[model samples]
Target chain A: MDNQDEIRKIQLVNQLDQLETISRFLDELAEAWDLSIPFVMKLNLVLEEAFTNIVNYGYQDNETHEIVLVFEKQNERLLVSLIDDAMPYDPTIAPDPDINLSAEERKIGGLGIFFIRKMMDKVSYQRMGSNNVLKMEKVINP
Target chain B: MMNLNFTEVNNYKVVQIEGRIDTITAPDFESGIMNLMSDGVTKMIFDCTKLDYVSSSGLRVFLMAQKNISTNKGMLKVCCLQPSIKEIFDISGFSQIFTIEDSIEYASGS
Candidate 1:
């Protein structure tokens, strides 16, 4: 049998508590795909940043919105995409925090997006119809 | 699952955090820092030996505590971070902004 690329997916609502579910999902993927704990955590941090951004500021209504995460192992590359129906947001273009700034000069709010960009090897965002898709990738063992 | 244990060493209020600090638990972490600041406990040491993971949410709390402590002329130092967590601190430029020590004793100057 040809070794086909493996794919796993989890659906979460735009809520902070779902981060635990996301962590479990990533942990399960690590166990199945033989990913390192540190690598799993890197992905975890990236997803948490993106997920928190959506939950806190993506939507303006009280209604619940669904966010789907698709994880795929494409040979040596690991890829994950976040799909949400919230307002159009592009995390990749957000200005990075001034890392050189002292504590007094730093701002608390922008570091979430900055962590996402710094942790992932490649990050891209696209507004597909009504959904916001943020794609992230990392090549393993390079 | 996460837990924060507080201990006092000299003038430093050492906060030892265990488990991952993610989106769900960040609020608790924030309140813990806030409570300490309000109590006027100046010198602080964040013992992170058991803290394996931290997202930006958690980092924000760290920054907040630092800002609050510094403004009031108090010291905040983080010690015993796991390498992975330390890398997060490093990449986020947290290493530069916080006084990081290799041991809690060093952090508390005890």
Candidate 2:
């Protein structure tokens, strides 16, 4: 990675609209770097789900919060690290949606996270002090 | 961003949605379809050939449109789904409820 290409960061308000903006930013970045479409789509979906989850459910009082997203292209993959100041919650601990249930029978919610897990090559969640950090990476090839 | 073009083919109101139909765009989609319904254009086919992606919110709008059309004694058809978008639909079991076709011609034929 070049010194200038090590990392790029953006600060977003915890809101639904941020999902599209972030996805577009990542999409353009991926295309500029010649990343695969599948990889870009997977990363966009994961970020969309994660950020939306935070904006919709993470804050109990609906107060303003900031989410920092960092994009970096590593040796063989792209790494996106999201840091947010919100309540402590681990998405990985959430129960997997029962795929057996029909759409009508299944309860609403949780589907986004499930899709993210299926799409991303790697996902990690951690809470450090006041920041909830989510790091997801995907290999450029296969 | 999605470019939505509304037109008529064989007297059936067809909505062509290009680009990703995800959360941010689904609300606009729901309103657009509902506008068609208000105009007495219920028998519809959503031409999704250019729709490269969709999320659960997009599915919700589809369900809303389906219910509205079904109750109005009309029909809604879906055609030309890209594979990435189709996988989401298939995984969500939407394929069972939606009248999916390989092409607009095939869907309009019925």
Candidate 3:
């Protein structure tokens, strides 16, 4: 394969409103890179879930933090790494919601991370210094 | 972005939701459903034909509606889901949780 890749990053404040910014960025990238809409929407879903978790429960204080999203497209693989300076939390450790349970038995929690695992081909988490990095990757289906 | 329209068909309030229902739009969508419930309106059918995308938050609202309808002795049916959204429902086990119909007529019929 060729050794060419495109990398881009977007910095967002620790606010729920930034969800629209993420969607817009992905929309523009998909249009410019000629990526399929469905493929990008999956990426968008995971990104939204990851971002919501960070912005909602990451920090303990009222201080504003910056969340960063790094995207790289190489060949047939698309990878996104979310970096945040919030408390040390690893999303990959969360248990999946039991899909076998009844509606009343199931809790509303855990589905976001579940989606990240289900939609992505690879999901890995790392604690680097003060930042928690969650990297998700998916192979483009041609 | 989301657009919601409500109509009555065969004793069921059919709510047609269009566009993506992500974190940004979920609260609004939830409130819209809440309004219907507060008005003592139950036995509803959710038409998701144009709902191209749904995130975890959106799924939560769906679950809430279902639970509320059950508690009120009413029924909540979801119909006309796009394949992509259906895959989400399947993965989340929502397909078994709610009554899913291929058409709004079928959803309202029962």
Say which docking band candidate 3 falls in.
Answer: high
Candidate 2 positional error at B88, Å: 2.5
Q: Across residues A52-71, which tens digit of lDDT does each residue of candidate 2 receive?
A: 78887788876778899998
Tell me the deviation in Å of residue A32 in model 2: 4.2
The local distance difference test score of each candidate is: 0.89, 0.79, 0.91
Best-matching candidate per DockQ: 1
The segments of candidate 2 whose C-alpha lies over 4 angstroms from its true place after superposition are A1-4, A98-108, B38-42, B70-74
Residue lDDT tens for model 2, B37-90: 898887899999888777766777887787778778887899898877777777
DockQ of each: 0.83, 0.34, 0.82
Q: Which residue pairs come into collision in candidate 2?
A: none
Count of backbone clashes for each model? Answer: 0, 0, 0
lDDT leaderboard ranking: 3, 1, 2
Encode model 3's per-residue lDDT on A48-91: one tens digit a residue. Answer: 89999988899999998989999888878888899999999888
Cα-based lDDT at residue A122, candidate 3:
96
What is the per-residue lDDT of model 3 for residues B3-50, given as tens digits with 9 covering 90 to 100?
999999999999999998999899999999999999999789999999
